[model samples]
Target chain A: MELQGIYILWLRDLKRYIRARSRIIGSLGMPIFFLAFFGMGFRRVEIPSLPQNITYIDFLAPGIVSMVVLFTSTFSGISIVWDRQFGFLREIMVAPISRTTISLGRNLGGATTALIQGLIMIALSFLIGFKPSINGLLFAFVFMFLIAVAFTGIGIAISTFMHDIHGFQIVINFFVFPIFLLSGALFPISELPKFVATLALFDPLTYGVDGMRWAMIGYSEFNPLYDLAALLIFCVTIVFVSAALFSKMEVE
Target chain B: MEPIVVKNLTKTFNGFKAVDSINFTVKKGEIFGLLGPNGAGKTTTIKMLVTLLKPSSGEAKVAGYDVVKQPNMVRKNIGIVFQEPTLDLELTAKENLDFHARLYGLNKKRREERIKEVLKLVDLYDKANLQVKKFSGGMQRRLEIARGLLHFPKVLFLDEPTLGLDAQTRRKIWDYIIEMKEREDVTIILTTHYIEEADKLCDRVAIIDKGKIIALDDPENLKKMVGEDVVSLTVNDPERLIDELALEEIRKIVRIEDRLELSVVKGEIMIPRMVEIAQKVGVEVKSVSLRKPTLEDVFIHLTGREIREESGKNAFWRR
Candidate 1:
């Protein structure tokens, strides 16, 4: 029963995104472009103490994939706002489904979109000279899924509190952007200011990026096990928080 | 049995009561109307009873379930058409209905069948495959009604369902709604600012204004409360006539539209006296007409204001 609901919602989400070709391009195209630019820009640049076999672009591919997932999942919150403004949200709210089911369905839908975009980015990364083994690809997919779910929960949680489209956009800019920038998606946490680096440790996206990057290139500042564990814990926390908030939200 | 009941139901917003201890009941399969102006509490009361908003202090029940405690159950049995157009503009009318069917947990085959039935009922079967953005405003409203009926809900709540539709389309939907109520034995509670809509469609109506219900009864009985008929005389000076009529033995003088409207047990007898008095005082009588008092008259008599007075006049096509 749960799986069916999840599949239904996931399909609905994908259908909406696919119907709008521009949305698909912006979500999937942006990440691939960033990956290509970075991969080409540092293909031959040698670092002072880096291993001979490691290339900067190859090291950066996994982080870009993780970033793709993050962006897609976070923006998925806008659907919730749109649904409210458009009256679809009320239709769902008045349905007999449990509030938890609603949260789960929406989160899973968003996670699926993020995962699909992440895979597309990974496929493009291969074309741009970043290569990973079969096992590495599998691990990256799993890590991307986890990150997607986590970010989706964060998106849902934010969605419940927004009353208007403008308010929702403001929240995305205030919270999502900060979380994305500080998650070490484009740069290492060690490269940030000490206080910012300290704050990054608590951000859920940090674990997703670090874990996916470690899976791709086997290089990360944090242990892969720790990162995965933190992400799971964060995902659970976000889902529960979102479910509770959604249940408390009135449909007016 | 009462399918729904409200006892002292009140909802306050920002320290102002939107629904002020309003009380009413609806029996099974009955059509109930909540008639009020733009800022009146009709919508708030419906929202509270539908469990969309918690009442400030009072309580209500819907479908034998307490709106506050068994909200989910109440939601399960009731469908709603909000004032605003809520259709997913990007989806075809059929897909929109299909999505609603799935949400209600209908099986795939049953979902498709129900969608088809409702599409036909709303006269939208031919346009089902067309995206909602391509639909006319009337078509979109019909699609919304179709969506609301997909689950065979026991009750349907329509908040201003015909607010912005053309008169012809509005009447067509009213006919469809009445047919649905009869054919399916579904109880329908409708809230509307249109006085004629409430008069023509509702079996019982509660006149609400400024958060309180001023009168509740069958439309005929409520209209009778105003008296046999009303005499409206648009005089050059309304205040002078008000003072002049204040002294006369007129039954009740209600001022509306810069005119003096009086409800008399025998308005035909009182018309000539009023005209003579208007002439004596040099009050230029623009015109005089007498007709049976309508729900609008009842609203003014009870609330001391016209039903649609406070709100901006809605151009026929603007709504």
Candidate 2:
């Protein structure tokens, strides 16, 4: 029954995602913009320690992939607010299944869609002269999935407290921007001042960006295993909290 | 045994009573109604029974399962159509039913059969593949009902099932609602502010006002509480007029907007006497119309207030 509930919900989200052609263009557009502008502008600004053949675009490719996951997964979680506004949440709430099953379905659906969006970013990265090995592509897929799961959980948890799109957009503006900026997606955290670098280490997405950076460009400040562990723990905890909060959500 | 047994169910928001201590039971296969004006707690009461909101106090059992303690049990036995449209407008009619059926743990074979059954019951089989957004208002409402009955729930909650539709469309939805009830053999708890809807559809109605059930009985019995007929008199001095026309047959006298509505057993005999008293009292009788007691009249009789909103603000909600 749990699996069936999850499957139905996941399928519904997948259907909606496919139907909205503009959403694909919208989610993909931001990452490509960041990659093109940063990749072109920073090509000559070399960091001290350089590997044999990696360009700044190749270095920024994985961070942008993580950015893709961050955008798609979290926005997918915003469907909760839309569902509440449209009254579809009430239908699901009154059903005989546990809220946990519903949350799992939503997170998985968001993660899968985020993975697809990440895949698109990867394809887009290659087109823009950013290159990674086949092994790196496979690694990027796994790490991006984890990042998507974590960000979607965070978004769903945050949305349970938000009533409308305006509140959600405000939160996305205040919350998602800081997470992305502090995760060292644009610059290496090692170059930042002591306080800012310390703050960046605490961001869960830092691990995500760093882990994907290792896979895509073979450059990471921390051990890849620690980064994976932090993301895994963060994903599980946020997903659990999201489901608990959602179960208590009110409907008028 | 009754499938729904609500006892002293109460809900409050920030110290304001939304649903204050209401009790009633619905017999198996019966069409019961929670009839009240908007913000009079009709929707609040329905939400409580459907386990969408927790009551501030007291208890409710739907399909013999405690709404709070055994919400899943209550949910499994009951299906609800909210006052707002809860359908995934992006999904096809068949897909919507399939989604709901899967949540109820229906196997693929049973899911297929039930989807077909409910779609045909609502007479939307041909349009089953069409997205719900493509449906007209009436078609969307019918599809919602079909989705509600997809799992063959023991009790179905229709919250303003015909609300916001044209009169012709409303009548058509009514046909489908009644048809769904019989075909599914399910007890239905419908909440509506539409007086005639209660008169035509409900086997019993609990008329809620100011968070309380002011009257509860079958439509006929409730109307009988207001006597046989209502003779409404518009006069200059309604209070003085009532004193002079003290007919023993006059069951009740209510003043509503310069008009004195007299509920009487013998409206025919009393109308002339009322006119005579108005002349004697210099009441300046302007007009009088006698009509049979309807559910609306009964509601007004019990609550002493009209069902329609007079002021832009809701008096009940305004502390």
lDDT of 1 by residue, A134-241 (tens): 587788787898888888887777777777778866765788778878887766788787998999998888988888878888777789999989988888888899
lDDT of 1 at A195: 92
Model 2, B1-319: lDDT tens digits are 6899999999999999999999999999889998888889988898888888899999998888999999889899988887778999999999999999999999999999989988888889999999999998888888888888888899999988887777898888888878777767899999888888998999999898889999899999999889899999998887787677676788788888788888988788888888887887677989999999988888778777887654223322211
Interface RMSD of each: 1.7, 0.9
Highest DockQ against the true fold, candidate: 2
What tens digits encode model 1's per-residue C-alpha lDDT throughout B37-93? 888988888888788888889888888899999988898888888877777787789
Give the docking tier of candidate 2: high
Off by over 4 Å in 2: A49-52, B310-319
Candidate models: Cα lDDT each: 0.82, 0.86
How does residue B287 of candidate 1 score in lDDT? 91
Off by over 4 Å in 1: A1-7, A167-174, A188-196, B246-249, B265-272, B312-319
lDDT of 2: 0.86
